[model samples]
Every structure is written in structure tokens, then in C-alpha cells.
Target chain A: MQLRFLRVIFICLMSVAGMVSAAADLEINTPAITALKNSMQQRHNQLAPYYVSGAVGLTRDGQIVLRDANAVPLPQRQAVNALVGAENQDRSALYREIARANQHPEWESEIRSTFAGRWIEKAQPGWWVQDSQGGWKKK
Target chain B: MTKKSCIALAALLLAACVTINIYFPAAAAEKAADKIIDEVWQLKDGEAAGGKGDTGSTDDRPATKPGATK
Candidate 1:
């Protein structure tokens, strides 16, 4: 009876070891995600001028994701209008710019929240950013 | 102690360790941003140095040459 008990204990220990090993081998592909996140951030910075002039609009998979007009000057309203008009006509150029900036494949969903988080972190006083839930907040 | 009680105790201990939450580090995020931005700056520099030819390809003519008569 003692021998049988020892065998069962040994089997349970071996199963537990297997579970631990499996968990250890579970590698999260975080680097790719991080690279993509960083690329989006770089794109945001590259487009900062447009954003400040209320000229930048971003969408993911045909859904308007972010519409920002935080730093637009009152005197440059015409410029803003012109840019918006161009964007409304066709934002393909803007999307292409972002995709190139990130070195990411076209048609990949741009995770706007990741970029938003980065922007919020770097925003100067009184600048505005949209949160993950699309709520506007001042930084 | 009963065998069932011993097994339950071991399970409880394992669950405690497994349930620990890893907090997100803000410093890590900042570090990541700095590194990425530095890489971007290098890319821009390379483009400036003509390592990547024709930066003008992406420029929208209307935006760049504002004084052009229509």
C-alpha cells in the first residue's frame, strides 16, 4: 500500500512539473506589439504639425478613431479648414504616411489608444488628448 | 491531517502565487518612448543624409508649395 501511495505521489509531482514547464515556455509576443506601438507613436510625432493645426484625422478599419483640434490657432482657421477638406476628400495619403512611419503592413488596425497614451504622456500643459473610451481630456 | 485537506492546502498555496498581479511600470513606458523616438530621429537623419532617396515623394505639393499660383 505504501509503494502504491508513493507511485501516485510521484505521478502527481511529475504532472505538476509538466504544468510548470509549459507555463515557463509560454512566451508572449510582446516585442512585435511594442514595436508597432512605438511606430504609431513616432507617426504621431511626425504628424504633430498637422495635428496642432487641426488637420489630422485618424481612422482604423474605416472607423474614425481620433479627431483632434487641440492646438489650432484661431487665426489659422482657414488653413485648418483647407486641411480638413482635403482629409474628407481622401485620407489615403495620411494613412499611408502613418503606415510608412510605423514600418507596419498596410491594412493592419492602427491601435490609436496606444498612440494616445504616448501622446498624453508627452503632452505639454493645456494640450488635449482623447482617451481610450474617446473622452477628451486635458494634459 | 486528512489527505483531502493536504491537497487543498497545496492548491491554495499555488493559487496565491499564480494570482499575483504584475503592475505596469510607467518608467518602462517612458523608456520605451525615448528609445523609439531616438530610432525615429535616426531614420529622419538618414533620410536627410540621402540614405533613403527622395523624401519629397511623400510631400503633398499643395502643402509644401503654398505660394504657387493656381
Candidate 2:
């Protein structure tokens, strides 16, 4: 029947909409968030060389791990840890703020996982990044 | 019901059957992730600064979505 055909078309359209919604970008900007981003950006200057030298690597769960401790000079290891610790603090807040801003704290884990992949995906060649299976490889 | 109607009914039944799905909006999650990642690492000055943010631990990764099957 014509009615049955129309129903099928309707369902198909809805399914397409559902997929589109899933792919939509998420953004959460505010004064506090702006500050967090700025601070993290500023810290990158200090962290960049360490990443290049192979002292740290990006992890699969959106965190950092000391990839090769020897890459940092013996005395500088403590400073590097302090820096990573601070950077991670801000990063965590940034993720939480994003989820909260979206009005779905439940989405935090999903957001983090997505970032986990993107961080590795966007890594520069030779920088260590964890794979989906949790193996750290040079990108 | 006619044969055609019965076939249609069977197809509808298959479509309507229930199954557990932990809806992971992978597409949406990826988009959202990329946008944030780009912004956080958005510096064009070429910095390999991808690992810095840390708010809290859900150290427990959310469960992986189970494969689709009967």
C-alpha cells in the first residue's frame, strides 16, 4: 500500500537523522574554559621538547605516560613530572567543562575516548601515541 | 493475509525485534573529539603538545560496545 511505502521512507529518514546527530561536533566555550585553554597552550612550549625527545607519550585514555624517563636529564625528571601533572590537571578540567557545558556529564567518557583517538591521530611523526589496542607506537 | 502481506509482516517483525544496544554515538563522539583536540592543540606553530589536560579519573574506560549479533 502507498501508506506502507510512506512509513518505510519515514523510518529511513529518521535513521539518517540519528546518524547525523551522532557525528555533530561538540563545543563548550566560556571565560573559565578560555583561561584553561590558554594556560594549557602556554605550557605546551615547555612540554613540546620533551615530547620530541621521547620523554612522554600520549595514552589511549586521554592522558600522558612517561614513555622513556631517560629522555629527561636526571635532575630534570622531577620538573618534567611536575609539568605533566599540571598539564593533565588542566586537561581533565577542560574535558569535564566540555561535558558539563553540553549538559550531559554522561558524555564525558565518550568525549575523552574521542579525544584519546584524536590526540594520537593528530600526533606528529615520531611522537609516541597509544593505539586503540593500548600499544604505544611512534606516529 | 495474502503471501505478499505475510512476507511484509515477517520483514517488519525482523526489523522490530528487540536487542540490547549501548548507543555509542561514535560519529558524534569523533566529531566532538576532533574539534576539542584541534582547539587544544590548535597552534599552527607546530607543537606536539597533545597530552596535557587531566580533570578527573574515569580510569575505568567505559565498556566497549559489544559486537552486533543474534
Candidate 3:
């Protein structure tokens, strides 16, 4: 009788754990996330021209890259490189901040992948985006 | 074992097996990402029309966002 009772109890406990895992909320916001979003927003205007010219592309891992240095004028190449670096820094920080805000820093990679898909999906026409196979294509 | 002791042992076993299993919320994360992307890109579909209507007016734009302190 005790063995059967224990088995039933174990199954019930497992189901409860499953339910808890299923209901996690990702939209939980904090000041850190808000700040990161605003920072990225401000940088977007400066990066827009590079994106339009295919000089910068969104990578599959949720970061931007200077895909075609030749697309930028030689004189402005250094500035574009710096802008790409800054944009990438902010992107990674945003992913980390979101995971930290959710109290599960281990979820950083998942959060990044989610953002990667969104960034590519929302990319403007003629903007370059990396595919799952790491190839760039203009979209 | 006594009935009470058996119940205690079962409870202990159950507690040991009921480990915390927090899964990543992928769908929610995607939704959250979209919201942030929309803001970062300022991708209003009607932006051009709106801009033409409110030429030289900056009221719609938020006052300067504090730049990142790199």
C-alpha cells in the first residue's frame, strides 16, 4: 500500500513541476531592460545608413556585423567599425540583462536566440541578415 | 517499518525526486523581443505619412534618450 501511495505522490509532484516550468513570464520588465532598449534605440539612427547599404548585417546569433567594409567609404570605415562594435556590445548586454531580470541567467542563450529571430524578421528591406547556416542574404 | 515511519520515508523520497525544472519561456521571449525591436527600429509603418503631416515638429519623438555610457 505504501509503495503505491508513493508512486502516485511522485507522479503528482512531477506534474506540478511541469506546470511551473510552463508558466514562466518573459515580459517581466526592469529598469535595466528599459535602459538597454533606449540605448539601442538611440544608436539605431546612426546605424541605419550602414544597414541600408548592406555594410552591416544582422547575424544569426543576435548581433550586428560589418559585413561589407567596401560598402562604406574608406574614410568612414573606421567610424562604421566603431558603430558596429558598440551596437553589438549593446545587443549582447540586452540579452544578458533580460535573462538576469528574469532571475535565470542560464537562459541567456535562449533569450539571445529569440531576439535573433526577431531582429532578422523585423529587418528592413535590402538589409542583410544571416541565415541559420551562417550565410548572409539581403532581405 | 512502522506505518508512520513508512509515510515519512515516502515523503522524503518524493521530495528528493521533485527537483526544480524551470523551462525557458521561448514564446514569451519572442513576444518580448518583438516589442523591443519595434522600439529600437522606430518602425512605424505609417512613419513617412506621419512625418509629412508633421513636418519640422518633434513632438512625436521622445525627448533625447540618454546615450549609453560606454
Q: Which numbered prediction scores highest in lDDT against the true structure? A: 3
Greater DockQ among 2 and 3 belongs to: 3
What candidate 1 gets wrong by more than 4 Å, as runs, is A1-31, A57-118, A125-127, A131-139, B2-4, B21-70
- Would you list the clashing residue pairs of candidate 3? none
lDDT of 2 by residue, A95-132 (tens): 78877775667777877777777888888888888887
Residue-level lDDT for B28 in candidate 3: 78
Q: Candidate 2 local accuracy as lDDT?
A: 0.69
User: Which candidate should be chosen as best, given TM-score against the real structure?
Assistant: 3
Docking class of 2: incorrect
TM-score of each: 0.35, 0.62, 0.70
Tens digits of per-residue lDDT for model 2, B1-70? 4556655854664453311113445676676666556656653322333445643322343455688455
Candidate 1 per-residue C-alpha lDDT over A6-88 given as tens digits, one digit per residue, 9 for 90 to 100: 55566656666655553332221255443443344345444556554434433322222225454555676566565445433
Q: Could you tell which candidate, 1 or 2, scores higher by lDDT?
A: 2
Which runs of model 2 end up more than 4 angstroms from their true locations? A1-25, B1-25, B43-70
Q: What is the TM-score of chain B alone in each candidate?
A: 0.31, 0.31, 0.36
